[model samples]
Target: MRFPFFSRPAPAAVQPPVADGGTLLETTGLTKSYAGADGELPVLSGIDLTVRAGEIVALLGRSGSGKSTLLRCLAGLLPPSSGTVRYRGTPLTGANPGTALVFQTFALLPWLTVRQNVELGLEARGVPPRERARAADQAIDLIGLAGFENAYPKELSGGMRQRVGFARALVVEPDVLMMDEPFSALDVLTAENLRGELMELWDSGQFPTRAVVLVTHNIEEAVLMADRIVVLGSRPYGTIRETVEVDLERPRDRDSADFDELVDRVYRIMTGRPKDGRPAARPDAERTDPDRPDQDRTERRTLATTPLPSASVDGLSGLAEMIAHRDGRCDLADLADELGLDIDDMLPQVDALDLLGFAEIHGDDLLLTGDGTAFAHADVQDSRALFAGAALDVPLVRLIANSLSGAPGAAVRAGFFRDLLAHHYTSEQIDRQLETATDWGRYAGLFGYDAGRREYRLEEPETGR
Candidate 1:
């Protein structure tokens, strides 16, 4: 199902759909190689893929997979070591016309303001100044960055920075929009909001992309937004599975037996393991009540963290502004959207880290304890390290991974990632990427992980214990 790109497009009539299955972009047995310490490291080999006029396909795999290489080949960023890529029936040797990508990093020019960044795409295409301004305006408004055009990259929050990346892509009105974990750097709430807006624009025909090819590790995200899921096999790189025509239904029922069934299958295939050992899904609020589990479908937690009191207060947010802006905390709205919480949500997660002697929440200001701040700065994705010592006694990474993976459209609170480590993952992996989410939060942290004894023990830690 192709979600239309422009719900409320410009007054101009939409163009007719590009013919289906006629090679909007086609790659035959594509392969890529790079020079490594050992020399001649093969990245992608004999890869075959076809994207139609309006297709959104997900390339799913673990870290070290060749998804990035393939994306670069298609976008013409890197020349393929072997095989061929064809766009609109013509072979593509390099960055072809009419394609744009939004990367995990904003990669905006540090010196350029948001307005200049959005305008760069058009300027590259040689669009005249008058037309460039018009297109930039539309793209900025499209991504909700109307008044922010003049802000430099350093002045914007991570989420806003990402918008600049996206707006640059949209301002050109490319034929295909390719993104590599585009929201991976953002907070859950911000990612959801951006995704919601993108879906609305695409479906409404306001942003009619000819095709969109997104690459991500989050299986639930792939399932939710993609029309097809392409699973890549281990090592030496290539496609092992292409399961098209997924039938989970729209606004997906994650708790439904059917959704789990598909998720289970995909999880097994992607992990090189069978479906038998994976855990169930639950968030912190649900874990609080053992007898009464949180049910899905009716009212899910609206945000990822708890709300603050009725009146505005200082130190409600994190040390974020306290260090940069020189305040313990800031207004909820001043909080970074990419950081995922307003002042209301940030304080609790900060406190969660505090209770385990990981952090301190004083006057609503998030001050990471000595060790907490160290862990916050470390590389925490190592699976073994995630479970180290007493940080997590159970399968906490699996808990968080499953919660995010299974929840799909819903926001997995920031605390879900932090507290899960209280019970699961070796201290190593958690310290690498699982525990420190501010970096790769979008892809890895959202769907927490677990090895076995896989179950949802999602509970808020006993306060001040």
Candidate 2:
């Protein structure tokens, strides 16, 4: 439940025993790909995983890391291009009665009341009306929505709607419950309450599900809920980087030293830094010189393989000022609490600042450099100039800017940039990257984009002003 920095790691439980049963779901040689203009774009590759009854497995990775893809495969919502997904020794074909999926959107029908929505699955199977109604009523009560069973989805709060989602999944008596960022959309207090309630249900053996597969971006949530945490990498395909078991007892202590160390260890793994204070090999094919610190920072700054910029300059500056105001350096966990941000929201801001050399991440704390401090206090024009300089140095930005400046009227078709980026990323990824570039360009007064003309043009001195 805490996002403390992990530094010292304790030994995990070796061969932790499954409380109830044997392997409930397993995947072998799991691979998934989408059809691209050139060929197939692989998302997952050779992922071998197993889940036993009574175990909770959390798949943790960045947003575009294919965590959701893997979960979809396991739930039989989407078929993998290649590989096998077996449920209790049977090859899973499509939606199975033994499996249920809880979505982050709380995918409920607004026209249906809570009880009716909960019983939708049973109705699909043509269960007797009386039997289905009884099961739905029981499930509603189980999830603490007993009195609200007659309320329509539109009448309930976000958390209540999500609880209805849980009840719907549970009503089916599924053997495996697959959750894709189930708590991400709820308020903090509500999410924590739901997490606690779910854990209690699992502990008491009161739920229909035997095992849970959770896909999340929150390392703290993973540590708190999972028996095993699987770290995934993003590149040609999503691959398993490492698997760690949580040895701590249930009802985990957020302030425990062991918890902090484990969280730190996961962070290091995610960032490609080893716990022994050594640089680990990046999962991508392009390798960087571990000896050159500048190269590492350079790699992050470029848009080569990074996701769309999720944080704006204003957001970054606000965080920098907060860091300077707090203590020149602040613990990331404490900062998240102060800023009212989840780990998912906080990471992108941290990464943006770090990539720009304005701030640095060390263990669990963030430190602002002298330039960063000055920028935090600078006027709007000064900040834009500073950001513009940094933006021009990025490889993709530099290439685009150079190409545009060389042309007549300092203009180039938007497709020119997309074509250039497609060589390095898929079409889908290229779209996200281009959108991010546009944001950065506008912020720094580096360029102007014409959506109707489908072109990018160099900005004059007074263009934005």
> Which predicted model would earn the best lDDT?
2
Model 1 segments beyond 4 Å from truth? 1-17, 36-39, 273-465
User: 122-145, model 1: which lDDT tens digit per residue?
Assistant: 676566767777777777877899
Query: CA lDDT of each candidate?
Result: 0.56, 0.77
| Worst window of 10 by summed lDDT in candidate 2 | 1-10
Q: Give the clash count for model 1.
A: 57
Tens digit of per-residue lDDT, candidate 2, span 1-465: 111111221111122333565987889999998876457778889999998888899999876678999998888889988999987777888855467899999999999999999989878766677778888888888899999989998999999999999999887766778999999999889999999999998888786677899999888899999999998877545899889899999889989999988887787666555565344444432533212234444455455565554677677888888888876688776666556665557877887776666776665667776667767877888888877866765666666778875443588898887876665567777776677678778888778888999888877656753
lDDT of 1 at 168: 88
**Model 2 TM-score, 2 decimals:** 0.85
Q: TM-score per candidate, in order?
A: 0.56, 0.85
- RMSD (Cα, Å) of candidate 1? 17.1
